[model samples]
Target: MGKHALLSASASKRWLSCPPSARLEEQFRDEAGGSPYAEEGTAAHALAEHKLKKALKRRSKRPVSDYHCDEMEECTDGYVAFAMEQVELAKQECKDPVVLIEQRLDYSAYVPEGFGTGDLLIVADHVLTVIDLKYGKGVAVDAERNPQMMLYGLGALELFDALYDIDIVRMAIYQPRLESVSTWEITVPELMEWVEMELKPKAVLAIKGEGEFHSGDWCRFCKAKNTCRARAEEYLKLAQMEFKAPPLLSDEEIVEVLKVADELAKWSADVYAYAQDEAVTKGKKWAGFKLVEGRSNRKYTDEEEVAQAAQKAGYTDIYKKTLIGITEMERLLGKKKFAEILGKLVYKPQGKVTLVPESDKRQEIAASTAEADFKEE
Candidate 1:
């Protein structure tokens, strides 16, 4: 189908985690704002492609040594700089390095049922090496069996099958930021299975706008933060446990209590749905729970206001709050350093506000307030 209809290797896994509606929302936004991690990885790919192609043209000339060393202007900039260096180093070493095909190769059909773009494709000694670059911090990429890389290999095999004596499709993950390389060989049948099993259904669902909600740590980053039933249940119980007073259970007992919490969570959703219906139909109030629709928290407004206030309080420069996005820090301090700060920014909804828990407090608290008024002196 089209780019909008197609599911990439990464987005396919995301589709398995949550139902189609949620997955579609995420996949579409991917094009709109371009994820920081993706942007860096793509930039690295572009830089590698550029340097490799330049080296190919000068295969007969002296090596181009004037490398751009500006202190990684951004995530993409860092990846491009580091990757370009590697390409130059390769150029010096290899006697007959192949062409560095730029972003022109569209290897969609090679991925079986899935469609993916190969980052860099090279040809040497009649063998094809498809190198995929990963610029994220969490996990070191393994190329040998990477679904994405495999698909890229499949694409390359198809494109160059007739031109050269195809020996083998070699796949690699050039994780520059991690200072490592992972690689694998792609057999024809294995690639076919990936297409039939993983690619086809995921693509269909993605195109049709349906997704399955599977849960794990990735749920924390999901955009449908408040809407997920399983996530909602977990957080609601955690909040309730926080407010629990007296007779605190031991660790083992706490685990047992969580089983009961699961039951309570189901009742809670049912109750919430009933309340939402009443609010909309009977009470004529907006029904759905209040969500964090893009919060621009902690601005220099308070800083500016405070700075102005401080100007009156006898201070000149209270310096604008040095706010930095997590992505920027990753470029400056590297991925390891940036992750420390990013951990705190995970999405946790304001679960209580606009929430109609089982208990209503006004009637129960009115008598206590009246008693307190009479008892006060």
Candidate 2:
């Protein structure tokens, strides 16, 4: 697998769950550097590294990026502050705490050529902590039983287990955008037990592409998600499953539908987008679907000219003015200044309740009154 490992630590979730997907995804190589979101995440990581290095008293130059903004600055500052806190905690037990920023960790001992770059690694006292920064806010990341963090912990152990006699492994995910700061601690023996019993076997199957294809939440980041047959089958099954019940659905049936509703909608949208692109770009057509001119709203060729003409014609009411949104206002003023100036003026109303699966980590709302309380000013 050239420079990229077949069982890369970042993609471990997909491979470990559905080992065959590792090779299946090899056929669909994404475009260079992936999507705009990926590029933004890369920049965030670079900025984080610069900030953390400087915080640790190491010489480093500040990074320049289009993504550099108040939000990125605030997030990176939070990350550095967290790392410094860990360092101080480490100092309580050990004379010298080793902190590595943007550390290249190799866990090839457990998996074939398995290596990943961790955002931060702190080796102090008997704790080996691996902290990672996730810049995206689309999905919240959890540190509990996360393969990526576990793998990073293993790589850190390989480097300092003997030197520090590390007994405990701690992994944290610092996702500032989601306001997520999750940390999970495990004993060295417990981590190794998981490696030997679960990870090693999964790695072996993933390298050979010998295991069955299983689909779940892990399919989100898979490269072949849009085109994979297994995913299509899964979503199709979910969609068809919805309508097969009786006219008046039972409580159990309603619960079952809720499990797959969100996933089904996402899959349908992805398939439609891919199909539309293929029909337009490659002249690929499906028998049932046909190309047609999509609906569009009218627009002026030159807005300034149109405005001038309208004013000259005694029609000066073309403008519609409104106050900027809360987000825009916050962006206009920096987060701190915004809070200081308008904190009392702003109030978050109660959110309307929605039915989500039990596994959702969000606290259950008081549905009895939540919907009644939702209102617009």
Candidate 3:
């Protein structure tokens, strides 16, 4: 097995939903080097592990040498502090609490050849808590029914069941960048029931490469997502719809078309990005597309000297003092502290109304507002 398992816990959400995705991805080699965001996440994880180890007085051979940065330091500190709070709570409920950081967890019983490192695990009496620190800010991850966290909980239970009697499993996602901490709890029996009914069957088909290819939001991070035939067919299905004038379609039909149009736009962007990467980096070319410089802006070689010259030429308004943005101010003061200091001062205006599918989590506008707006005026 490589650094990451074929049926990795992090990718459980994808494979469980689209069983063939695991086997499909094996056909292509991962691109060289890591994305900047991924690298930053790794750095934040390293710092968090180091900080936690130091707090527990455990010696770690690895050092946060290359991953040391101000932002990472603060982010990891926040994670360690939050995890310690959970640990303290567990300690209060039980006589003794066992805390482990950066522990290797194995879930081969449920997933074929699966294993992953858990960021933090605390076992006390009948409660087993798994805390995951997500440094990425792109999306907010919730713990409720999250396949990844459930897999981690299973692995933790497998490792410590012999020593501890764990009945309730609590999974938490601590996304410091998004200032979100979501927790979900389930009985151990319920979790195991899911493993037997849902996970095991999917793993069996996925390991044998005998499952159908289904696409959804889970395809966002797949290596072959841009070129996957299933996804291409899905987009093509949208294209096959008749191009009727907008005014002729009913309200319901318009909503359906809008959904398809959104997906088509995203698909086109993904295909374009993939083609650009292939042509520029791997020397692969499409029949009609050629790589060329898009645009550029002129820049001064010596910024300080240019500024001095500009000032000498009577350019005094070139620089101005601007207050830092709310995000940056919050980062500097810490999220909780910032809220305590300015919670009353900050007012968030209501966002513009948007049309979304029923599956969207946001609450729909009040029927009274809709009725008033459409009052036959």
Candidate 4:
């Protein structure tokens, strides 16, 4: 597969929701190299693919030495185990179940120049399952009504529907770092219905560059988010709101403002960072802002020499020792081995209460329960 498809399944959530974004993003050139986070994620995926393929006795000719790391090994091992569990479950239901690793899926029928690689695909009697490995911990991806996974399902259906008597499609997102394994199921007919109705129209508009720009949470990952006129207008509406003497706002108004504030803050920060980079690195200047050296602390030219001089001066107090962090210890010993050895020594305390939006997935604590717990303490 090509490095990037114009309407790539990964960005389906953004472009499908805001069809005009596909064309708008094409106007700007992407940064030359991937971000550190993207590179880490890519390495993790390579390791996961290697592990899975090795387990299946389908190892690639390419060496996995460059991608091998302790953390990557652990994360990929978990992903492989989870995927194998799903395959085993499928095996129980079908006479011959097949698992495909890093399978290239084509969704061009529903999206122009769209395709994505499924980390794992399992096909069994009247059922197809698509598993995706997400190494990033920035956001928890849900499988429910996920357009990306749905498009993958469509691609898998195009490839295997004729071969297998598939009726149900299962989409799973495995984020091992977050300990999240979310799965959602839909009938083949329902998926096809969505493709025929919602997907095809949007895909056509996106490909033709003939749709209106609408901003929401979907703009979070859009390349043009920082400078998008629609987003600016949306946030500007909130900024232009009438300011009372005490800045009193109705509950409904507060809710509306809160919804836009998060995205607005992120956009503002992104714009600032982009402008700073342009000014300092590319010799481009903004009208009001000038680049300057950020605050930093002085450091010794040679730490070893400084340490020797300090010790020779009878500075014994400079030295200290401490136990390794729990996370580092667990990493060194391996999670299971560490838990087996020191399970009883570890204790988890109740986390402090914090305010969050109602949409947060965490269960809310009752006031009575909090009072009762405090009394017991």
- Candidate 3: Cα lDDT at 5: 90
Poorly placed runs, candidate 4 (over 4 Å): 59-62, 65-67, 245-247, 367-377
> Which regions in candidate 2 have their CA more than 4 angstroms from the true location?
238-247, 370-377
lDDT of 1: 0.54
Q: Which window of 10 residues has the lowest lDDT sum in candidate 4? A: 59-68
Residue range 109-216, candidate 4, lDDT tens digits: 778878998988999989999999999998899999899899899999989999989999999999988989999999999998998888999999998877888988
Q: Please give the lDDT score at residue 27 for candidate 4.
A: 93
By TM-score, the better pick of 2 and 4 is 2
Comparing 1 and 2 on lDDT, the stronger one: 2
Candidate lDDT values, in order = 0.54, 0.86, 0.86, 0.85
A best-first ranking of the candidates according to their lDDT comes to 2, 3, 4, 1
Error of 3 at 66 (Å): 5.3
The collision pairs in model 1 are 17-214, 18-212, 19-211, 19-212, 20-210, 20-211, 144-183, 144-184
Estimated TM-score for each candidate:
0.49, 0.94, 0.86, 0.92
| Cα lDDT of model 2 by residue, 197-299, tens digit | 9999999999898888887889888877778888888767755654654657877877777788788788778778888988999999799989999899999
Cα deviation at 230, candidate 1, in Å, is 5.5
